[model samples]
Target: MDFGPFLLLASLEGLVQAAVLSLTALGLCLTFGVMRVVNVSHGEFYMLGAVIAWWAASILGPKYALSGYLIALFLAPCIVGLLALASERFVLRSLNYEPEATIVATIGILYIIQQTVLMSFGPDAKPVNPPFYFRIDFPWFGYSGYKLFVIGAAIVVLSGTWYVLARTRVGLIMRATQLDRDMAQAFGIPIKRVYAYVFAAGAMYAALAAVLIVPIRQAHYLMGADPLLMSFIVVIIGGLGSVRGAIVAAVLIGMSDGIISMFFSPTLAKMVSTLLVALVLVFRPQGLFGVKTS
Candidate 1:
C-alpha cells in the first residue's frame, strides 16, 4: 500500500530469489572451478529437480503434500547427482574433459534434457503444493512462512558448503586437484574420481535449489532457460570459477530485480543488471572478489 511496506515486501521477495539463485549459480561456478569444464547442461539438472518433484507430488497425492515435498527434497538431488555422475563418466570423460568438447557435449545434453521433458510432461507449467501454508503478518503486509524457510534452508546449505570447503579433508583434496590436476595426481590423488564427484555435487546443488523454488514458481519444460541465463550472468559478473563471487553476485542481482521491478519493470531491472555487468567488465575484468590469474 505505502512505499515503505511495498519496499519491504519487495526486499523479502528478493531474499527468496537470492537464496535460490546463489545455489543455482554456485553449482555452475563450482563445476568450472574444480573441473575446469563448463557444464551448459547445469540448468537442465535444475529443471529435472522440479520435474521430479512434481512427479513425486502427483504420486503421493495432495493429502500428503508435506510427505511429497520431503520425498522430492531428497530424491531429486540424488537422482540428478547420479545422472551427472553418469554423464561425467560416459560423456565428459570420453571427451577427455577438454574444455571445448565438454561445452559442446553439455549443450547437446541441455537440448536433449529440455526436449525429453517437453515430450514426457508436455508443454505445461506444473505446480507443486507448498509443504506448509501460513502467513506472517507484518505491520502493513503479510509474508509467506515457506519463503522464510527457503531463505533459512539456503543459508544452512551454504554454510555447510563453506565448512566442507574450508575445514574438511575432502575440501583439501578438491582444492589441490583444482590448483593443479597433474600435481594432485602425482601425489596419488585419484583426479578422475574427484572430477566425477565434483560434477555430481554441482548437479546436486542445482537440484536442491530447484526443489526449493518449484512450489513458488511451478515447473515447466523450458523453465531452465532463465535460470541458465541468470547463472551465466552471475558467473560472468562475479568472475568465472569464483564461489564467493557467484554468491555475492546472485544476491546483488536477485535483489536488484525485486526492487527495480517493483519501482519500474522487470525488463528494466534486467537491463540494469546487464549494464552493471558491462561496467564491471570494463572497470574490473577480474570481478569484485575474483583473483587475477597469470
Candidate 2:
C-alpha cells in the first residue's frame, strides 16, 4: 500500500478512537463541571457497561445475536446510570459533596465494583461478537463496517447530548446549578437532585461509549484503568467542565495515539500524550477552555 492510503487508513481508525474518547471524556467533564466532583469510579462504570454488554450478549446471542446485541446496547447504559445515581445519592450526597471526600469515596466505589466483578465474573476477559459483519473496501484495504457504525453512533449521541445541554429546560437548570449552587438553591432549583441526575448522566455516557467499543475491544475487569487515564488527560487538556474542549482535545489525542501506535509503538504514543498533557498543565493550568477562577 502507498503511504497515503496507509495514512488515510490510520486516520479512519483514529477517528473511531476519537469518537469513543470524546464520549468518555465528556462524561467526566459533565460530572466535574456540574457537581465539582472527581469521580474516580467513572472508569469502573465503563468496565461494568462492557461486562454487562458481554453478559447480555452471551445470554441472548445463542438464539438471537442481533437482537441481543441491540438490547445490550440499550440496557447497559441504563443499568449503569441507575447504579451511578444510587452512588451519588447515598454516598456522595451523604458526604456533603466535598471534593476531596468524594474523590476518596469514588475510589472506594471503584474497588468495590472491581472486586465484585472479579468475584462474580472471574478474571477472564470476555468478548462480545459484533451484530453484523461487513467491510468497506478501501483502495489499499478494507475497513470494518462496524467501526464506521461506532463513529456515526458516537456523533449522534454527542449531538444529542449537546442539544439537551444547550437547548433544553433540564440543561438550563443544570447550567444554573453549575454556575452558582447556592444561588440556584436559593431559587429552589433542587441542586442535589440535579447533581444526582448529572452524575447518572455522566456514567450513562461512559457506559454508552463502552458498549459501542466493547466488540472491538474485549470486556475485561482491568479495562477501566486506561479509559480513566485518557479521560482525565482529555478533561485536563481541554479544561475542566468544557465540553467543546473535551471533544477537540479528544480528537487531537485520539488521532495522535492511533497514528503513532500504528507507525511506532503504543507505549511511545502514550508517552507523547502524557508529555503533551504535562506541557498543557504547566503553561495553561486552567486548561485550553477552562476559565480562570479568582
Candidate 3:
C-alpha cells in the first residue's frame, strides 16, 4: 500500500479514538466546569460501564447475544450513572462540594470501584462481541465497520448532549449554576440537585464512551487508567471547562496518537501527546477554549 492510503487509514483510526476521547473528556469538563469538582474516579466509572456491559452480555449472550449486547449498550451507562448519582448525594454532597475534599473522596471511590470489580469480575480481561460485523473497503485496505459505528454513535450522542445544553431549560439551569452557584441558588435553581445531576451526567458520558469502545478493546479492571490519563490531557489542553475545546483537542490528539502509533510506537505517541500537553500548559494556561477566570 502507498503511504497516502496508509495515512488515510491511520486518520480514520484516529477519528475513532478522538470520538471516544471527546465524550470521556466532555464528562470530565462538565463536572469541573460546572461543579468545580475534579473526579479522580471518573475512569472507574468508565471501567464500571464496560464491566457491567460484560456482565449483561454474558448473561444475555447465552440466549441472544446480539440482543444482549444491544441491551447492554443502553443499560450499562444507566447503571453507572445511577451509581454516580448516589455517590454524589451521599459522598460529595456531604463534603459540601469542596474541590480538594472531593478529590480525595473520588480517589477513595476509584479504589473502591477498582477493587470491587477485581473481586467480582476477577483480574482477567473480558471481551464482548460486537453487535454486527462488516468492513469498509479501501483502495489498499479495509477498516472496521464497528469502529465506524462507534464514531457515528459518538457524533449522535454528542449532538444530543449539545442540544440538551444549548436548547433546553435544563441546559440553562446548568449554565446558570456553572456561572454562579450562589446566585443560582438564591434564584431558586436548586444548586444541590443541579450538582447531583451534572455529576451523574458526567459519569454517564464516560460510561457511554466505555460501552462504545469495549467491543474494540476488551474490558478489564485496570482499563480505566489510560482513558483517565488521556481524558485529563484532553481536558487540560482543550481548556478545563470548554466542550468545544475538548472536542477539537480530542481530534488533534487522537489523530496524532493514531498516526504516531501506526508509524512509530504507542509509547512514542503517548510521549508526543504528553509533550504537546506540556507545551499547551506552558503557553496557554487557560487552554485553547477556556476563558480566563478572575
**Each prediction's whole-model lDDT (CA):** 0.92, 0.92, 0.90
- State in Å the error of residue 283, model 1: 5.8
Model 2 misplaced stretches (Cα beyond 4 Å): none
Cα displacement (angstroms), candidate 1, residue 275, comes to: 4.5
Question: Which residues of candidate 1, in runs, are more than 4 Å off?
Answer: 278-283
- Give model 2's TM-score versus the native structure: 0.97
lDDT of 3 at 129: 81
Tens digits of lDDT, candidate 2, 25-62: 99999999999999999999999999998999898766
lDDT of predicted model 3: 0.90
lDDT for each residue of candidate 1 in 114-138, tens digit (9 for 90 to 100) = 9999999999998999999989999
lDDT of 3 by residue, 172-231 (tens): 998999889899999999888899989999999999899899889999999999888899
Taking all chains together, each candidate's TM-score versus the true structure is 0.96, 0.97, 0.96
Root-mean-square deviation (CA) per prediction: 1.3, 1.2, 1.3
Candidate 3 ranges with C-alpha deviation above 4 Å:
none
Screening candidate 1 with a backbone cut-off below 3 angstroms (N, C-alpha, C), the clashing residue pairs are none
